[model samples]
Target: MAQYSPQYEMNRYINHYFTSHACPPQETQAWFSTPYAMMNYCQQNRIGAILPERFLQAMGIAKGYCELEPPLRLPCYLVYKKDNPKYATIQVFVDYIRRVYHIKK
Candidate 1:
């Protein structure tokens, strides 16, 4: 098995779901250096939905639509068919977080 650094693990986690509009080299580096901060920002920005959506889509939850269990009360629907909706959503979330939290990473 290959030995992985903390930075490498953080990068893998972030890039697995999030992609930048431009190159993400700087952002990736920042995330590697401050994974906890990145996670805190995500929590503050209410990004928990992003992961569920990604997982549902990966499990064949119809294009543009997600299935939510009861008690959660999340609105799930088929909005549109896109090639990379998860990536797009992630980018939007990133932008929102950056703007709302003054993130400079």
Candidate 2:
């Protein structure tokens, strides 16, 4: 089987979570900005990923229990709507993820 990159797995998790929750795809982009940002939001909000530990392990990410560089992304859209200023901040993160991780619709 082809192993997915940590970033790719994170994208799938985000997409699945938002879609299952009936969130529009556009709204999803507005929600997390990027996978890394989403992870940060999850950490802050106690919203673990589908396979929280596994996902983190795959990404080489560590949370409160581990000693690692804190992920440097933010979930601006998690607390605001698309029309809000924070949404723009999220959009920047999303763009970065897309460019850096090659996330596609």
Clashes (backbone N, CA, C under 3 Å), per candidate, total 0, 1
**TM-score for each prediction?**
0.20, 0.26
* Residue-wise C-alpha lDDT for candidate 2, range 1-105, written one tens digit per residue: 111244554566555655666767532222443546667666677444333455577788665444223322323333457787678788887788778967674
Q: Cα lDDT for residue 41, model 1? A: 47
Candidate 1 residues 1-105, lDDT tens each?
111234554335434433433334322222223334444445465332223454455556456434533222232233544666597886677678778968675
Error of 2 at 80 (Å): 5.1
**What is the lDDT of every predicted structure here?**
0.43, 0.52
Candidate number with greatest TM-score:
2
What's model 1's overall lDDT? Answer: 0.43
Which sections of candidate 1 miss by over 4 Å? 1-85
**Cα RMSD of predicted structure 1:** 17.4
